[model samples]
Target: MIYSIFTALSWGKDLTHLFKRIEESKIALAIFSGKYAQSKWCLNELAKMKTLAEKNKLKVIPIFYKVKVDDVRHQKGEFGHNFWKLARTSSGEEIKQWKEALEFVSYKMGLTLCENRYST
Candidate 1:
């Protein structure tokens, strides 16, 4: 269902439209994988999801795939390494928003899939 909404957009499409769709969604499922923080778009979506959750009671379900919740929350381990690398080139406000979003989602109860579980 979520992918259905995204199917209309092509690769490298404008994110503004995606953000609008996110605002309209009743539920948002964020899959925080190893490279999640590396993508600014993902972080922006997470930030919007957090705002929606706070103001509109939008349900946010985070699925940690091959990543630890602690790593995401504290920005440690591989996720931290990459995030900090990104922070070096990003604006302060942008990093702040990403950090807040990661912290907010990490605290919520979510499912974590072990690295081996999804590997062939």
Candidate 2:
């Protein structure tokens, strides 16, 4: 089964409900793109996934979609630019958490889809 924020109808459900679903799921796929780090909601979901992986042994598969793994791991290039832009309006603690989550996922072994894959 696939769970996507855009497709999921979560009118009254809180993030805890989403996290709980993540925790219960057998596998979680995190598709990291250029603007992924710019959204607080995305960062929070990733952070929760990381925590669940460590504590509950939930498996997380990171997929780099047209983005460099190094850029995500180190927060450099486009990912860095977008993240910093979001950081401007975020608290230090929030930024720290997002950074930590990015760092954690970056180190994991994942598939990377380069620009050529999507090019015509």
Evaluated with TM-score, which candidate comes out highest?
1
Backbone clashes in model 1, listed as residue pairs: none
RMSD of 2: 3.4
- lDDT of each model, Cα atoms only? 0.80, 0.78
- Segments of candidate 1 deviating more than 4 angstroms: 1-11, 116-120
Steric collisions counted per model: 0, 0
Clashing pairs in 2: none
lDDT of 2 by residue, 8-84 (tens): 65435778777766666666778889998787778888888788777756677789998888899888889889989
Q: Per-residue CA lDDT of candidate 1, range 58-110, in tens?
A: 77878889888999999999999888988898999999998999999887777
Clashes of 1: 0
Off by over 4 Å in 2: 1-13, 117-120
Error of 1 at 16 (Å): 1.1
Evaluate model 1: give its lDDT. 0.80
Q: Give the TM-score of candidate 1.
A: 0.87
Ten-residue region with minimum lDDT total, candidate 1: 1-10
